[model samples]
Target: MNRTFNAASTADDVLDGIDLRGRRILLTGASSGIGIETARALAAHGAHVVGTARDLSNAQAVTAAVLSDAANGGSFELVELDLSSLESVRRCADRIADSGPLFDVVIANAGVMATPAGRTREGFETQFGTNHLGHFVLVNRLASRIADGGRLVVVASASHRSAPFSLDDLNFERTPYEPQLAYARSKTANILFAVEFDRRHRARGVRAAAVHPGTIRTGLGRHMGQEVMEAAIEKLSAALVAEGQAPFQWKSVAQGAATTLWAGLIAAPDEVGGRYCENCHVSEVNDGPLGPFAEGVRSYALDPETARLLWRRSEEMVGETF
Candidate 1:
């Protein structure tokens, strides 16, 4: 899709003049980094925001000053949501659903990257359970409740290009667990989830889009040391050897959140629904090493058949249907 923003664009830059008053939005991982900035920019524009964090006390401490930033009487509320736990995801969804406002936008911006191997309470891979299936359950719980013409934004990653997800062993029960591979698979699931969500709900006027928040320095790396993260980057850079491509550049928290804001608030619904966005535009499906800012979404992540299959799989995993 043709767009009006880029990597250097901040959340406020994309939100300029956008009157978000009365728009109800739920943002996950809002206690820190890009999530805070995204919540701040929308709140500054007069939107009502419910920001979720795993620890209520910590989130409250980090955001004690958040509500003070809102303009035009916009308000900010903090809620507990541990996406890694299905029970917590359900409780959070229930509380939000009972809050009386159908969300105008749901930003699934919370995620973990390259963490050491582990499983959620449900025994799914850590990255997949938290980043993909958790949000899958949360959104499904809220699907019927989102406002018509609303947006659901999944923050996926360019690492989805690193590997195709293995449907045969989604839990890694058969394959040995590798951190980067698991992370890539989870991210691919993010894109597929968005693609299928759009196909299923666009007719009802609810749209979904996935985004690649450009490489950024954040607490998302707290588990893996900088050297380990760099090792993963080297792996990607080596993949470019035959194609002669450069490594990805980094962005600040504000800039990292630009594409999410662009997809959720700035772009027209039909232009981006069911698409993967990067550098603030609908990205091409390119999974190979390529020129600057031309990184593509993998075909597997956008495959309608795989998306449907994953949908069924996710429903079974969560013990629910949308």
Candidate 2:
């Protein structure tokens, strides 16, 4: 029942003919790249957009960019949000909640990729803290105000397939922490969050989905050293050449934003809830070993039991319940 789209498709293409006039949408990390592109496309189709960034200046720049685009006929507003801190999450959610009208869509697209081992304000590992825990608390705080038919989209990564869940060392407190492993754990948590959220909230008509925005160049790579990046690029190029394919197979930012747009607006509601998506499609679960990015979701990421357990654990960690 899963459908497929490709890297060549744009956000506008996925959103074709979809009228969103008057619908209120909130996008995190909207200051640049895919989040900004998605906001522009949504606004162009007439949705009222509230975009959040860590810096007021960056948020304003994004807002100005959206307003300057002729296709974006609807209005755009900016808000301050620092995902690394739970207090910031609370304040940001409180501010949005106080602003009145409910949001029809919430896109948790802000994220940090592989970074050096560290912890958040709450003492959780940085990747898990910012990418998954922040969004978890944000959604729970805003649950009351999310419209009946609203959608919550968590922008995950195919990298989640790189590692299975590690319940014992989720924080890397005892185990030697590898940055990619930490990131993969966080991404797994993203899928688990969506699956459990949908399980709990879908009965009320609100749905949640996790998306893998195809490998695209973005600020998420800011943490990597230049040598690491060059090495990665070289490996990718060699792999492409070995397969007789073009080097730099990643999509443009606009192209990368298509799956998020599709999951947010186009895919059949019943067809997608609780599933993992990439390249604008619900990925088919592969039975055997995977090749690099082609690895299917791990059992831990998809297990309902694990999802529920993680949900409870996350609530305990954040000291907040929905």
Candidate 3:
């Protein structure tokens, strides 16, 4: 696939002239930010999108435009899923898997960012539990429900470069809790999950890829107070400037979602499987300790051995093997 899209490209821009009639997509975090835009663009192009949110009524209220204005037989449906709870993840996956038609694509887009020290209902770190482990369990459970040749696009972050993952200290038991580092570790786990998932399923034609949506101001930052948010932004800007890269420029929701749509629908499976992508193109790996705003995948984030190890540890954490 040619690289025609950039950071400024919108989801609608990426999907233009593409027809998705009869396609079925499962998208998490459907009620907010880029998730809503992604669902709207797909449904507008004739795909049947089943979206998962913690609150169905709120999701319906927010996505009314997508449903009411769907074209070419496109449509949207909402399902309840609270990623912070393993029980909720299991119930949502079981309901969708048991209910008829198989999915053509699954976008694990829901996530929390820079949250205060906390634990999920299942006794795991809030960020890791919801952003990585939650999707780990849900996606694995639905693996059988995805049709052959299906794609899994996990919405990771360039901030994955923020910190290295520590499987041994997954819940921060030995380390002091720092919100940003915890979130970064979780994002790295997202990439590793995609790497391992693609390796495990590609032979059966189910390929998975992780994607960076760029910086976008959304409810994902609700956990960060204004002063902390400002300080973090200033620090990130300084680092990028010092590195001779442009300062961080926030992407709109549409722009943020463009890479996800591109990776899932436009890029060839072989090119994207087991890869990390951003700005609508597969990213190169940089082993250096670069600024979080820098573009490219960290070599550590894609190590096959690490990915495999994470998979094994994750299974043990959830007490279920895929």
Q: By TM-score, who's the top model here?
A: 3
Looking at model 2, residue 297 earns an lDDT score of 64
CA error at residue 77 for candidate 1, angstroms: 0.4
Report, for every candidate in turn, its global Cα lDDT versus the true structure. 0.88, 0.85, 0.92
TM-score for each predicted model, relative to the true structure = 0.93, 0.94, 0.95
| CA RMSD of each candidate after superposition | 2.7, 2.1, 1.7
Clash number for each model:
1, 0, 0
Query: Model 3: residues >4 Å from true position, as ranges?
Result: 1-3, 235-247
Error of 2 at 264 (Å): 0.5
Please report the candidate that would top lDDT against the real structure.
3
Q: Which stretches of candidate 1 lie over 4 Å from their true place?
A: 1-3, 230-249, 291-294
RMSD of 3: 1.7
Please give the lDDT score for candidate 3.
0.92
Residue range 215-288, candidate 1, lDDT tens digits: 88889877789887788667767766646766555688889888999999899999899999988898887766
